[model samples]
Target chain A: MSALRIALFLILFSFALANENPDAHVFPRPLVIEYPENIEPRFDDEVRLKCASWRFAGEANNLNPWKTIPEECAGYVKDYMTGKGYESDLLRASEEAGVYAQNVELGGDGKDVWVFDVDETLISNLPYYYEHGFGLEVFDSVEFDKWVEKGVAPAIKSSLKLYQDIKRLGFKAFLLTGRSDRHREVTVENLKNAGFQDWDKLVLRLPEDHVKSATTYKSEKRSQMVEEGFRIVGNSGDQWSDLLGSSMSQRSFKLPNPMYFIP
Target chain B: MSALRIALFLILFSFALANENPDAHVFPRPLVIEYPENIEPRFDDEVRLKCASWRFAGEANNLNPWKTIPEECAGYVKDYMTGKGYESDLLRASEEAGVYAQNVELGGDGKDVWVFDVDETLISNLPYYYEHGFGLEVFDSVEFDKWVEKGVAPAIKSSLKLYQDIKRLGFKAFLLTGRSDRHREVTVENLKNAGFQDWDKLVLRLPEDHVKSATTYKSEKRSQMVEEGFRIVGNSGDQWSDLLGSSMSQRSFKLPNPMYFIP
Candidate 1:
């Protein structure tokens, strides 16, 4: 083909691709189904009660109380994991955090720390959840551990951007996760592979460090960080347990998460 | 003066006025001082401790423990009362609420309600706080009651806009306040004077409805609203008590209020 004809053909192909999926750039395909069966009456009292139970009280017998997740439940997960709105929300939150972080006069004593959680926060496990029924089925630890070992979970783009922004703002980034010590090597590899770099410390639960709960364990770790003279200016997590409890950071940002309940 | 000369002079004067205060269109003169003296260490832990105490434990001896408010505390009040940022935040919140309220299929049983707190949510008491030292001094209930009786508090512009937006979207707006029942007549007068019209109900705490805490009082009122066959889709307040406890609406938006602590 002539050069002019080739150029015209390429332009036509690009237009066709754009028309095929206009929102591809803004909103990636949702990881979970838009609608799930059996979980009717979304956003009603029943769903709220179930969610509150799951949040406050752990799952019963390794199974969620409801037979199927509500449509809104699935929708919220999909929105946060793969929608434009969630991206905008995260960016706005990060922008606000950046403002706060910038305002604080750091002592430069290597004590200005910002805490971040791992799974579904920095690196998303949506690919795993998408395959396994999006929390409708019981959580299979062995399966999830294997998925984590793969070291290929994609970065939550907004959070990755925030991580880089805060790092530039001179915070000593600390990774605190509920993941067991057994997975530390893979977790580190995963984080590195998923574009996270040069975090000051990555703290995970030791094999013998049995704690009351994730909240208790995480809060204790944060308190230890404070005891070591670090000032936690910003903390971001998908779970309330990750943000709440004693030795709370100066400002805590809760990213959208409705997929699974973490005690 | 010659016509052209007079016109040029007027234009020059207007430009000067505009330069003197460019934010006068969206933001009125802030009710609180732009910088209040002695309110140093604005966003520090001291302010957070005091604010959290007042939020959870109410007041002691009618005094805030902090000798001076945090600058951020005062700034938040000023921003919400008269800042472009606050206006945009409220508009964004209202836009979200509009989407939710519009999507819900109300049963049309006169049951779809949106609860709104009175002070600092719908009609602002900035005019009162402007004169009363913005919680730097002990709260004088008698003085504030008199101010309420004046029936002249201006509407919070963003909230008023939201009120209208939700009303237009067909959710019955209910005014649920911590104000004592004695102020009902004046409160109604003030609301009307401030441009609020056709609200479904105005609920206040009666003398007989004595409760241990404001949370209990407000939560009970909300539960009562629910028992009346109203499904609350949106609830907004300047205080957490207005939105917490039982029978919460589907979604809650908190308007910024750092001037005074309300339990």
Candidate 2:
């Protein structure tokens, strides 16, 4: 076994010796501890540099339809998500959206809307993702549904602030998520308990739309909103699918989510 | 002077004391030394986290028409641009593009082409940018023109390899750049010297199209390419403008460029 694996074992043993939970999630899981086959272990900096590069490439939308974080980036993604990096990333995006919303000349007709993606945009999925190897493991929707139904996810603090900011600035909030209609109540309860309130619409996915890609489905829904004479001023999502294609908002905000990418 | 400024001064003085060039470019330029007028200097980790967040936001196309790196991120950008981060970023992007190109089914009609943006995409402008505060200062066209006239830019190594790889894979290369027609000869010479050769077409911006944004201009150029019956199998550029809009390629690859943004 690798030295890292041994260290993790000792760490877990220490926790167990104290009669504490030895669950993988109770301690930081050894996400991506193994060096990529090509790199020498001593070159730890190179691994991190590569991880940052992959994350940046992911943000540039180069890694479209990516299922999970690469094993190489698992540790980086975990640190980024759990540390100051993730918080500050969300803060910067929300701050930019706040500034954009402030400058937007909202039509007095209450037709202006700002679309917000539910998962990882307004709510923290860290609690769930934390248990799933920080995206080293492939996404499991069955498990995700159980997490969603729990309705215990906390607010992404930065986005909650943006949610209130845009609403106070007179733009209607529209929660558009990929969650199925079956989980609407729990998702709604999750959002409300997480400090979101008075959203104009919470549009969940219909069974008919399951076959459609997120970009296409979200675009079509936004097109429907446009047909109803509502103008989308700003849209925020962790996935580019929520923000790209025809009928996209005048300005789209992408919050960082290096963990998982939904096409 | 701030402590950082003094440290930079001492560093520069040391260079001069050894009869070395005191040119800001010879020594690393102090980019983004200020703490954004907000963050406490003791919290260096927060500053770095914010900088990384800003860079990621920039990659997501959040800061379009941005002129300069944030004052808080100058050091981060400089380090990122000059260090392993930039190299690894280019490597990842090129690697992805290579894999993408390898899998594309060629038309066998000799119509498959890969689009490449010139500056900072095919060639390294680090020589010029290093002297210009690593994009901490607003871009200067006049100074940039002088640098272009020198015809000394080097190849972005990873991209050069991808360029060769795609051409070898039976795709035509279309050098689509925002560089004006006046700089065509020098740019060609620079590209040739930088290890690019046998490209199918070198499309430069005409005087008439100077007022057009990079997105519109590149899109129109690409539209013309499509009109002429060349299939754009892949598009690669450091700018979103080079990758977005109508008539884009089947797969568009965005290289990391947080230094400067072209609208």
Candidate 3:
């Protein structure tokens, strides 16, 4: 019994020794940055910097240097749209309008409708600009507007898929973007190039205050959908801005975005 | 600079020598039993044994149990749901139903609606069953039913906070759990005791027809919402099961779960 106890003690001691940690490098804890105790006013330079980074920085790239869309993104876009129930528009005219239809029934009455957004929420020329490394320095409204005039930025593939899905479901998917009213022609043309068809209403952000919050634009669009007596079943976008105002809609969905924010 | 470089090199060498592991007492890597893979295909007895010795074993004290209606999860849930626009009775009913609602919108008509799920998606009773020495051995129908009848496994605080926020959102929230329909009463009672009031529905798993495919059940629920003319603005839960169905809805949100799964 005594020998057995010794053996057991030795075993436990050996186990402890085996489990003991040796001289090992320990990783440093990550540093946390705290906010300033007092708020500071923004300066002109800061405002320029912000606008430059968000909007106007990459203008030359906005004109499209890449001859073709990257295959991975294209494939992802096609699969995503197909998954969402988009049917291919074999007819060229239907495809140009960016219009597809979804069946909607509200209170025994059925009506046709469409939904859309603006800024990066609508047509994103950013990817082209980003690829070219343009616009990191200056905010050139002239260059940016010229790009919009060209209507060169393609619809984000996922958003396009969602657009096509809504159409497959039987309701017209409209083009509502935050691009100013002046850029409608270019924006519509851009959608056409991206394979969108039959977009009934291309609601642009009014330069005036017809709507309450331009930042909260989706809400304004929802009111329009209601006025048209269309049952808005699904709304999609990349930002909270698009869904913010649509408090009366049936549903709103957000697509994944790791690239940019609206504001 | 030269002296400093030499010093650094010497220090590194000393460290390496110190860690030479002369006794070679380096402990063996932990035995990783692939029990999760084993859970399927094996007989019940084998599953129980694997589950008994799984990572879920021997760490009950470190699990850090908490409660929601009892109060710890309020702040996080409130911030998240309120951010998503869940405002009044719908939010209230969600708390009552013991689920979270996110990205909700008021439909054109007064048809209030929300969506949820079962397992860790709604309530997390796994810790309790898994915490105590109670393995599948005590998972007999009578005892499990009794446990369900009690409904007080102590709410997970984060989930409760989300439930409360959803209740505050003003839409009627429903629970779409994967548990068998027979467990509905206990589930509902459990939610009520946790201080939630609006439980629009509890779509439990049917015994003979479990939702097997990835897309089937959620698609059905969303279809139900659509057919009923409920404009589901947002849906929330821990599992992919809850949000996937509302693919065409206005918004879909997900929360983290460290407890259970379906697939």
Report DockQ per prediction, comma-separated: 0.02, 0.51, 0.01
Candidate 1 per-residue lDDT over residues A1-263, each given as its tens digit: 35753453344323322333332333234332354545544465444433432321121111222334454455444433454544444444555556667778887777899999998778777767777667666788899987777655656666777799889978999999999988899888767765789999999989756555778999999999999989988888876678767788877766644467676
User: Could you say which candidate leads in lDDT?
Assistant: 2
TM-score of 1: 0.47
Candidate 2, superposed: residue stretches over 4 Å from native:
A1-43, B1-43
Point out the higher-scoring one by lDDT: 1 or 2.
2
TM-score of chain B of 2: 0.84
Stronger candidate by TM-score (2 vs 3): 2
Greater lDDT among 2 and 3 belongs to 2
Ranking by TM-score: 2, 1, 3
- Docking quality of model 2: it rates as medium
lDDT of 3 at A199: 69
lDDT of 2 at A210: 92
List where candidate 1 sits over 4 angstroms from the true fold.
A1-263, B1-27, B30-68, B71-81
lDDT by residue for model 2 (B1-263), tens: 35754564354334323332321232222222332434334336667877887888888877645788888888788777766677677878888999889988999999999999999898867767877888988888999998788676666777878999999999999999999999999898878876799999999999988999999999999999999999999999999899988898988898988888888
Q: How do the residues A1-263 of candidate 3 rate in per-residue lDDT, one tens digit apiece?
A: 65764453344223322322322111000001132425433334434323322111111011112233232233332222222211111111122223322323524344555456644444455433443322222344576676566554544443455566666656766666666777777666667765577666778778663344554665666686778777665555544456544444444443322233342
